[model samples]
Target: MVVVVGKEEVVVVNFGNSKAVLCRGGLAVPLSSDLKGERADEKGRCDDEAVVGRTINWNACHLPPLSTTSRSLGGEYRKQYIIMEPEVTVMKRTEQSDDFLIIATNSLWNVVGDKTACEVVKRYCVNGESGRLMSSDGSSTAAAASEAATALAVLAMAKGSRHNISIIVVQLK
Candidate 1:
C-alpha cells in the first residue's frame, strides 16, 4: 500500500487480492485490481477466451475447478495455479476528487463491494469518526485504526464471509 500526498496527485500501488481506492466525493476511483489467482485474467472478459480455453485445458490435465482461480494474488501454488501480481495507479488529487484511500484484503471485499465500503469510509470521514476512534481512554492511532478495522471485520463476518477478515481505515484530509 502506498499513498503520497503530493501537491498534485496521489500515487498508489497495491498487490495481490488486496485493494486501494480513491474515493472522491461520493464516487470511487479504484487504484488496484483483484487477483483471483486461478484465471488467466481479471474482469472475466471474453477477449481472453483463447487464453481461458488453454488454461482450462491445462488445469483439467493438472488442477480442476477453474472457476474460483480466475484472479488471485495468494502465495500457495502461485507459480503453478494462480497469478500473484500487483496493480499500480497514479491520479491527480484535488479538493473535489481523491477524498479517501481504502486499503484492505479480499476478506473485506469478498463480503462488501466497493460502493458499500466507500460509503462506510465516507461516513467515517464526514462524521469525525477518526477523531472518536481513539476514545476517551487516551488510546493511540493504532487503537483507533484497530477499532475501525474490527468493525469492518465484524461486518464482513455478518455478511457471510467464511475467511478470516482484516481491514485498515485511514482518514485522509
Candidate 2:
C-alpha cells in the first residue's frame, strides 16, 4: 500500500514477499523487504513462540513449509506461525530527481534485481516537460506505466520465473 504525505513524502507499507521500489535520479531504491521463513529474524520469531508441533522448516525444498511468506493477510490455521504485520517505510520525494515507483509480486523480484527492474521501467517511462510520460505519439503516463509493467513481467518470465507475476508502475516525476 502507498500513501502520499503532503505531496512530499511517500509512505510504503508491505507484507510478505511483495515489494516496493522507488527510482530516484535513475537509481533504484528498495522500500520493502522479502519476509520469508528462512530469514534469521523470521525464523527466530517462529522458534520463540510457545506452540506445540511448530514446524519452522520442513522436508520440502521450500523453507517455512507452512507458508512461503512469514506474513500474510489470512491463515487462521497457520496464525500461530504467520503474521499479518507489515513493514512501513517513509521516503521524502525529490521533485527534480525522483522518477517513479514500482510495486510488484515476488515472482518478478525472485528473478529481477532492483536496479534492473528500475532500469527497465525507466526505459519505457521517460518523462517529458510536464513530468509525465509523454511520447511524440501523445502517449500518456498510464499507457507508459502499463507498458513498463508488461516489460517487467515479460523479463521475469524469460528469466525462468514460474510463479505468477503482478506489477504496477507509477510515474512519480
Candidate 3:
C-alpha cells in the first residue's frame, strides 16, 4: 500500500490485498480497490480464458502457490493474469469532514469491513480512550495512532483472520 499525504490532498495507490480507507463525516470511504480477480474490473484485465472463468482456487488469480493477487508489483508465474500496475485514488483534504486514514492488509480486511474498522478507530481515537487522538500534542497523537493500529490488529485476529495483519492509522483531524 502507498499513500501520499500532501498539504491539500491525499493520494492512495494500492495493489493486491491491501486497502486504504478514509474516515469522512463519521463514515468509512474506500480510497483503493483490492486487486482481486473476483472484482469485475480486475477480472476483465486478464486475457487468460481459464483464469477469467475460474475462481483461482483461493482468492483471485492463478498461481495459488505464489499469491491470489490479480495485480502485484512482482511475480513471474502467470504474468499475463497478475499485472504489475496499481490503482490510484486522489482525494482533497476536507478538514471539516475528514477524521483519519486507515491502511491495512487483507488479514484485517478479510474479517473486518471498512465501516467496522473505521468505527473501531473512531471509538478509540475520539473518546479519549487508549487511542485518544484529538490532542494538540504531536506525541500524543502518535501514541493514539499506535494504539488504534494495535486495536485494529487485535480485532482482526479475534475475528479469525489467518493471514498476517498489518495496519497503519493516520489521524487527520
Report lDDT (CA) for all predictions: 0.58, 0.76, 0.78
How many clashes does each candidate structure show, in the order listed? 10, 0, 0
**Candidate 1 vs candidate 3, lDDT winner:** 3
After superposing candidate 3, which stretches have Cα over 4 Å from the reference?
Answer: 45-47, 50-55, 59-66, 127-139
lDDT of 2 by residue, 84-164 (tens): 778788888778888888899888988999999998887775455655654335568788888889989999999988776
Model with the higher TM-score, candidate 1 or 3? 3
Ranking by TM-score: 2, 3, 1
Residue pairs that clash (backbone atoms under 3 angstroms), model 1: 35-71, 35-72, 36-71, 36-72, 37-71, 37-72, 37-82, 38-69, 39-69, 39-70
* Candidate 1 residue lDDT tens string, 1-173: 55565768777666555777667766877777665543344534312434444334442222224434443444564444434444667877775445556778777887788888776655444345332334225555445555556666777888987564657765555
Residue 34's lDDT within candidate 2 is: 74
Clashing pairs in 2: none
> What is the TM-score of candidate 1?
0.63
Mark the regions of model 2 whose C-alpha exceeds 4 Å error after superposition. 1-6, 47-65, 127-131, 135-138
